[model samples]
Target: MDRITVLLADDNLIVRSGVRALLSRDEGLEVVGEAGDLESLIALAEELAPQVIVTDIRMPPTFNDEGIEGAKIVRKRSPGTGVVVLSQYDDPEYAVGLLTEGASGYAYLLKERIGDGGQLSRAIREVAGGGSMLDPEIVSALVSPAKDSSGLNAEQQRLLLQVGEGKAVKAIAAVTGQTPGAVDRAIGELFLVLARDASVGGKDALRRLRSLHTAILEREEQGETLSRMLPSKLAAKLRADPTASSRTERLTVTVVMSDVRGYSGIAERSDPGALAQQLNAHRQQMNAAVLSEDGTVMQYVGDAVMAVFGAPDPQPDHAERAVRTSLRMHELQRALDAEWQKEGLEPFGMGIGLSTGLVAAALLGSAERVEYTLVGDTVNLSQRLQDLARPAGTTVASESTVTAAGDRWQWEALGDHLVKGRDTPVAAYRLTTDTTRTEPTPSREEATR
Candidate 1:
């Protein structure tokens, strides 16, 4: 299972320990960071960029509502971050303050009744999936004596919630068991209700809803547009918003070169259709992992994927981001492997390389076939390192990259070797993903000429 990265914050060590112990038992939850104050929580959230945050409702010098306040700031800065606020207070209004704008990707839980950590795990999973959950007591406190109706029927209210969660009409239809046409009608009615509310009270909230509505429309369009385009170097150009073309400039970057190990043998053994489908899925996983870290996909050569970090734009932490992204790519392949195995399909094994140094990056070629390319010794080293990583599902990085990354990741040095295209021996560090089993080290001679 690909574990969900979590950042835990609590001023009380005892409380933090209890929560950590409880969460550690769950195989799918990984507490990657911990903070003891609101400031620390915010700092760690940005630094580590965890998928979910669990924070005590009060902490720091104020010891007031710092946790809830910090959670709001986190969600504001990164809308995709899931926050679960833990509180000793049973006040439903406190929870309401944390979710006034929208309830999606937010959760409020009572610290006392976490109930063996199941509810905590469930809440994390729900918010991580862009859904909402509230303590049952909290829910009853708000809904038991239902407030005055706002002229929205139950179905219309549900549709409004879906829209706030950024679900497209087709997705809403899938969930509600309705046709797309019916969902469209419901959305129109919901919009009208929101418009009425905007004219009266809560105009600010309605404005946010309007923005989300516009997002849904644009997302639908983007899906259509992306479906018709080839996604590679052009995607990088568009994503980076590069202004110039055919102009090369020196850029310090982390270059990642990955290859699908044993692709030739798999191609010869598998049917053409099956092989094509596997390649498509593999590319999607690799591309998504790279793009998630703000890295640019440089190009694709057969079964190889080239990614550049800090190019088209300067990223000081490019080395760190590239190493972390490599781990995610490894996780992606493992998850894909399990799924494909269940269906009797060929599984993909990935070898990743990362080299951080100065490089020349620019757009090249005519309008008919333009591409954003990276050219430098760093690129060559990355390729050699990836070939050395051919022990499937492995990642190897240049010594310079490992040093630049600091203590962020655990690595096992694979010693010095003359990697092809380089005169001197370059030391390679293997990012150790599985600590329990000792992976075989690549022989220097086998790794290069």
Candidate 2:
């Protein structure tokens, strides 16, 4: 990694030398220039355009707030440059003034705490990465009184302090040992609580909260987009290393495919709005079932849903998980159908299939659009197996899946049959939805799409 180039600005020659010495100890940081006054600071900032600026709160030739004012001017000239204001004063107003415009790449640290065990180095690195940091003392001084007036408990007040310090939701989640989604919901609830409590400066608090929240979200949007498109675990991996998905890898996995039975006829007979609602409800139920089993829902092609287990993150019990998810999908849809029937909506019957084998999986597409997809016979066989599944709410598995699942569920053999896109017959098994119901022979028409 390249070292973080920094420009140091302080009126005191001893202070500037000490700060430079501190930064020099870390090979990852380099002091590019030194400025002792507002005019020289602004001049060097424009000339050097360093990644970060470490400046004292007061400088020469009118020593009141020149550090902050000059830093602001540098940032305005080069929006990408980060500023860390080192202040001997822990007054909340200084911190607020430094961050009033925005807090994306800013830091406020007490000069007293600068010598405390790599704290200054960490702050410099953080701001260099477009993340902000606040002195713990400053954060506490800023938000301590809001505890009672803001209607927040101890834990909520702690969370408020982290937010005020410009921590991202992901960072907050890491610190609190909670999921990002949970942290987001907590912050939203905190906002509601603050909005309800009428206290002095409540409006200012809300404005700052809104601004900080937006900055955190905007910083993590790539991860957020990946989360919506892929599994949470997979998204985090990609977020940490963007190149993780670039290469294809082969792994043992189970592919699942499900389709709404008689979907064409249902669509033809039902009203468009009602059918769309039912389809939306059906997809939601399917998503919930798959996610509960830790499966990745790949796509929804009209009435068909495709899912995979094992790739992106390996799971040894992938076959069992896929089978369990398929059963759960059927059960959930049955319950949803019962409710839809009461509203005079046609019920949707589902046929699902599972196949287990080694397949190549990778995230593919251009910069504009991409998808995590599985390749090989396993994916194709799952679709073919779904077509062979007879009756509603039935799940069919290939011989490989049945073997991999290892007698977890009693299976009824569906005699070897020639499937489309294959020369030889593929053996299949059904996890009997109804014990008494006999197997129906698949006709030539049923075998084709």
Candidate 3:
């Protein structure tokens, strides 16, 4: 039997090398080519025509959308080529976008699992065989109950969930004991209820279906079961558990800051209607990318988006996701620019920053105005990092963020500097590929300070 040919694309050399080494042990697989950037990966796909391409979502030069864009190109050029995207975390919006374009011959897996060579090989084989694979976690996130209920009626929401779990209309009918036709009609109604305004007619129906399906899967995996009324006594007992309270204790978290590069300039030049349209488009793209990486959009301050990770739910890899999202956002901006140019509008740019440290993140403010948010020097530093980014650019992780990210990504010491309001200067680094780099040069004040 012919060995399955594979092309690997990841900005991190160590990750690519590790994956290649792992696959080398599999007799059925062969790593035919590799790329560290998006453009090269596309070129390699065209040249090698590999049976499979495993790509990282963010790659060098322009880190964002490279993997997805490359996958789309491979599908167009070599319809038989299977594309498996490896991301640091599952992004539902990204998954939705990919599936909407056509889900066959593709897979998206979390990078953490690449070590499971058998699973990776199996996924490759599945996609090469013309099947689709989505991270169960991503599927659950997309279809969370909150999202399904955002615009859907209770019945429509339930139907959407069932359909998203890959249930056939007949199977749905069997479960609900309704006729297949009725189930199908219910699905249609559900689609209509959730369809975006732009999807009123034409190809939008399919998009709506895909979105609903993806969302449902996400919710299911998150263990978000249907709401049930727990006995009041039991609920009170559970809430009174001291361990649960202790578990909620605050910890250091990474904060991500992003903003349009030239919001004021754009507002000055364009009419309110045009500016609103532009801002909406930008927001959608950013929201999709951020949410896909499991980052929460804390709030939108004018044209800026403040997001947080490592809180609400702490994941050891949150800092890595934050950095990766920042890179992807930069890439998305470029793609959006090309889109805007087609409409004769100026290209918009973005700036992003990330920082990690202990911060107080909990419900605060007056009873009526209470909300969940993070507050600390770390948060301020993250905001300052965003301020430091050049238009259409990004800066990542103060020394604290890098420490928290552990070994998930490569780091290069960019040196240390004093941030405003901090008594002492802090060490900083540029997030390199996934491999670790040498310690940054010691601060000039190492002895003095």
Candidate 4:
């Protein structure tokens, strides 16, 4: 069993010690670090990258909403880390403010409710999994103030409650035994009904409902931050032209797909909390590698990382950039793995695949959630080649990618191999580095096939 890593923050040393002591009793939880102020909290968050952060809503320097501000910064910097805010006051306003940006990966609890530590433990676990939790009193405080003068039916009011709790459409559908489309329609209709009611109380309820509804919708996307999720410069273009993502464009680009070689075996043997920390570290390094070459990190699903070297902004040397990026990734991971080995943790080995061809790229989704994606055979081939890249730290590139990248490194022809979803076999090349050469030596070998 893996203990959940946590960071505690409070201006008062006694309070911090007491809370830490309480959490220490739980064998499943581990305190990795502590901070007394907002600045220290942010610094430790970036350094330790703990699974969860438990902090006082007020801290030193200002003692006013520092915890909330610090949590926001930590979340932006490390989107995977969850936050549980402890406050002496049970004011719903602070909770609302903390959650205004988004409610997922956030929890607000009254400090007085930490009697048995069960509630605090539960909240920590909830937000750690990208779920939201609010103190019962805070929920009541929020709901009681917003009078239901909009004349919502029983079913509609129930729907409102579920939405207020930050439940996703799919989750709500499963619970209510309704289709996702039906749930979405119901929510839209519910919003329309609220809009129709213009009474003072109705307006208050409507405002709160709108905020909650938006937050819940945004939760569907990973990172819960739209700007951060998009490719570099794509967000700016979308903002300048809101409809830029509405249409598809054909582009000649290079796609890179990398996956941890033995993630499943590692997961089965390692503690869940420790594995999460390791994964976060791996991802941060991979992200830096990709960004260093101006590649866009499309997504990180579990142990897999998908990146694109051209699309939102095309480059003539996309293939070369991807090849360089792949090598850099392997280099960075090796250093990271060395550090992990020192910590008595298993190091990660990545198998990367690169494919270059024409792909139809589009930003798809509704106003609430959107994803920039590449579609077509190019994308599929990259994933297929990635499967062929085994034995760890190896990179496989498609024939097309090899041609576009030019002769910069030695190549080992993989020959024509049949891949899934295709009737014909695809040609691939292994990007080989010379152990003798300190720098990349331009070379190419003729394939006899």
* TM-score winner: 4
1 against 4, candidate with superior lDDT: 4
Rate residue 33 of model 3 by lDDT: 88
Per-candidate TM-score against the hidden true structure: 0.46, 0.52, 0.43, 0.62
lDDT score, candidate 4, position 397: 90
In Å, residue 180's CA in model 4 sits off its true spot by: 31
Give per-residue CA lDDT, model 4, range 1-449, as digits (tens). Answer: 55778999999999989999989888989998999998999999988889899999888898799999999998988877899999989877788788888877888898889765499999888788776777877766665544364567889889878876667887999999999889999988877777677764655666666766665665554333343367645765665675776789899999999999989999999987678888878888898888888888998889899999887889899998898899989998999899889989998999999999999988877787778889999999999999999879999999999888876666788889999998999998887763324464555555322
lDDT top scorer? 4
Per-prediction CA RMSD (Å): 15.6, 20.6, 20.0, 8.1
Error of 2 at 85 (Å): 35
- Give the Cα-based TM-score of candidate 2 against the true structure: 0.52
Q: Write the per-residue lDDT of candidate 1 for residues 61-92, one digit (tens) a residue.
A: 79999998888888888766888998898876
Q: Model 4: residues >4 Å from true position, as ranges? A: 1-6, 13-47, 51-54, 57-232, 365-368, 434-449
Per-model CA lDDT versus the true structure? 0.75, 0.81, 0.69, 0.83
Tens digits of per-residue lDDT for model 2 on 1-449?
44677999999999999999998899888888999999999999876568799999898889899999998998887666888999999886787788777665788899888989999999887777666777888766655545556488888888887786757888999988999889999998888777777675565566556755665565464333542365555666777776887788899999999999999999899986467557766876798899898888888899999998997789999997888888899899999899888989899999999999989988777787677778899999999999988898889999888778764466778879799999989998887643212344343223323
Q: For candidate 3, which ten residues in a row score worst on lDDT?
A: 222-231
- Candidate rank order under TM-score: 4, 2, 1, 3
